[model samples]
Target: MSDPGFRTGPDGVRWRDLNHNGVMDPFEDPRLPDAVRVDDLLGRLGLDEKIGLLFHTVIETGPGGSVLDGPGAISKTGTRHVVVDKRVNHFNVHQLGPAHEAARWHNTVQRLAQETPHGIPVTISTDPRHGFSENAGASFSAGSFSQWPEPLGIAALRDEQVCREYAEAVRSEYVAVGIRAALHPTLDLATEPRWARQLHTFGQDPQVVTELGLAFLEGLQRGRLGPGSVACTAKHFPGGGPQADGEDAHFPYGREQVYGGGHFADHLAPFRPAVEAGVAAMMPYYGMPVGLQLDGEAVPEVGFGFNKRIVTGLLRDELGYDGVVLTDWELVNDNHVGDQVLPARAWGVEHLDAAGRMELLLEAGCDQFGGEECVEVLAGLVADGRVSEQRLDISVRRLLMVKMQLGLFDDPFVDEALADERVGTPATVEAGLAAQAASVTVLADEGGLLPLSGSGRAVYVEGLSAQDAAALGRVVERPEEADLAVIRLAAPHEPRSDLFLEAWFHQGSLEFPPGLPVRLRRIREHCPVVVDVTLDRPAVLGPVMEAVDAVVGSYGSGGPALVRALRGEARGRLPFDLPRSMEQVRTHHPDQPGLGDPLLPCGHGIPLGARV
Candidate 1:
């Protein structure tokens, strides 16, 4: 057999000689059962190669979708160093270019993997990218892909079909670029209004979250995992909302997750549907539990990724979920970028070294390490008698079985021309825009102040582009000279600059700053003010709602979508309640839902022609 060898079977079908043995192996034959193939391939893998299958980390693409030749900022090493030398086959791809170039990059990486010893195909995964959010640690902005509103927007409509369509769009775009796994459809219920990661959740209602999340899971996996599907990883198992002080667990300051109101069961309610539906994967969050008791047992005070009681006992044994369990990013190692260092999210087990963390995570029943590439650490554990080779085989078998089921063993490359045609097509773009328009929640319209009539009326705007606002009416420099004032405000958060990733998360204090209400009052004195607030998380909006003639809540909708909603072209409802004051927000328990007096309740909305 040559370096790149192929063998013809009795049926005249060509198959890659994965082991280069000149014989058509069972793993190489597409007609064989997936279980038989996985078993055959698993027996052939060496210990170090099996260790590589347990790690999935970030891989950077070069300029114009070329493979990185040398070390880069994110990846910290060259492509061949990680792919061939390290024997890593799983990758999480971020910062992609145009569709055709991204497809070319995918094919390039697959070809590189084909020449390796066993010819294992690379399994590429990604965070949610088809939305307006652009946090580097979380999600990316929809660059060339079809753009839609946030997951909160999909939940606001409360339509399962719409959620399915949005997920189907995401699946189509991801599959075109050779992405096999989707790390999203976050089932975390947004019970804590101040949590920074709420934009990706469904809502506070467990029933709504369960129904819509299952639809989204089905859409992405296309009824089952196969060649045409992008496997969905329903995430943050046992829930990630209810952070202490609503701060994210990405930083050290927000490491604790408290269930003071005894609502842990409510938070765990949504994940049952995903488990029952046979979701392809699960991701435990980075937050550690504090004084939490589940089913008459006190859960260990560790991050969910390192808690065996949570991952193995609850998710696997109790829920009967046999899917792959992937830990959230960077649970085992610290991340250093430029002049800053983010310590490992070991949480309660901060004293352990990298190798100790790997051993504990495997014992916790997780299958793969997210955002980590320390194959040497895991290999050393095996050598030191801490981790047995049989334990390594368990995870490797699960990982390889997923790759086979996704049809990556048969063909992993994608057509560049087809990717260009399928991604961000006119139909997908229109559907996304329509969903964005439909997700606009009209909270208030006092005395019928919305649906502005003619286009010639003078309009004054703030926080909106002049080009997009021009479609409604003539743009004016000041509110005094215009017939109406349109202001776009983001739900408030106290800014923090202490940590590197903390600044990106909008945490602490949903109250509006002191000057905002006064500024809105001044603008309203000159002309009737209509305010649109982007509710990534629910806000305390009593003052602004009182001053403005109309208040509309937007869940990541763009300028054009807002204009369409204001012009009576779309309709939406509130997904969660808006607090009346900071006092109310403070007094309400973070883990409980619908327990306090709110300015506007969930499911509250005023239609375009209706008066509040």
Candidate 2:
């Protein structure tokens, strides 16, 4: 149904001299390309208007950044806009909660979008609306969006059809709620530990990631959000999971994207497929690679978002990506992080000002400035003509093109019925739980010794849910209450650098409270000690390796699967690798091998009971 000449600025339109201006007018159109309409709209607009659409502002709640889905009020208000002199049309990016409540949120946003002159109905995008945690940020709850399994759950099954189903369910949720896009199917290939977002990714294999990423894309955006399926913003492009020293970009004290000397390609693998698959947009990562950005034939300390070599050269030029480039939140240094931070991301990099960062990103072919607060500054640049009118037209036209492609101009209302039926379907939710079950990689089980059924008399639990712990056998929350203690860590919620990741994307001497492992040694003194990590990156397993009788690993899971694995009900030592220690992780990750756990050797977990 796609028009062949849709690439042209005008298509499906018969030129006619409406109003007799002796010029062809859109007023007499059979609907043209969004690019043409964009040009038409810009002709009558001021400098401020075009610049506003360039920034994707965040809704932060104190330290957590954006409170995407509402548990309460929206977080993080702004002090600056790209253009300050005049007010411009603004669009708020929202992460939907549940499928049922989408009607209310859609109406609220629609009212605001409709009131504006251009009436560009705000395009809402979520992480994965059909999945349980569409709002990646916890605490998000509402209605109208579906809830299925997370992508990792699907990957665990390794069933392509299931993955497509996840995408379809999510797409249905997107279209139903009037949300025109979804930002995910993380294709990150979670090969390493320490990267906080592995659960959202496909496995560590490139082929799988490529095949499924496209399938998910087709499922979501091929045809049905608004008038079509929701669009996708393929993220952290050029891939994000080879964390330097396995640290996350968001957590403070968790600074750095440690590269194992030559493991760059591991990170690059997933993205190429996404681009080839024709993702609507690409997101730049928050980490700045020292080797990736060749600054005039040399490397720079600043990251890709601000680095031309990485953003413009490698991604846009070398790869030939023509999609919208969105920055991953505030790229400027964080002065807002107060006591919560311990370490600081202070690498002698060129600390560009906020305004300067914006200018550079645009110059580097970035279409939208995500997580921006300095919209007024951008407006100033446009007003002063530092930013060319020609450039604005190009970016705006492309942006509008995406909107039209998403069919926002065709259908605008939220379909409450669709949201409910598609999201949180019985099959999808089961699949997510299955993914958790499948992803739980059992590292050590002592002597073919797991499925602790009745063996763990009064087992002590640390870190996860009581319900999840109960599945493992006898679970006790207090350390002293059980014969053996099993700890399930929550993935690093604290931003890296203990200071700021954008400030410095590399390694630090981070740990789980000094000598905390020694205490685990004492727990091992009682009977058998089982340690399970729920972190994206592998935690230091010094005492754990020596003292614990069993070990298990998981990412982004709340313990449902970990509990299943603990009972030996589930099989597999995370389809990826588990480093021997923090040292091995820092050195061998993204390139070498996972650690040596007896129960979960190399190719271990092979479904204990069910064939599925």
Best by TM-score: 1
Instruction: Please give the range of 10 consecutive residues that has the lowest summed lDDT in model 2.
Output: 1-10
Local accuracy by lDDT, each model? 0.88, 0.56
lDDT tens per residue, model 2, 30-84? 3766556656756755555576667665432222222233322332443122113
How large is the C-alpha RMSD of every model relative to the true structure?
A: 1.8, 7.2
- In model 2, state the lDDT of residue 432: 55
Estimate the TM-score of every prediction: 0.97, 0.74
What does the lDDT read for residue 327 in candidate 1?
A: 94
Give, for candidate 1, the lowest lDDT window spanning 10 residues.
Answer: 1-10
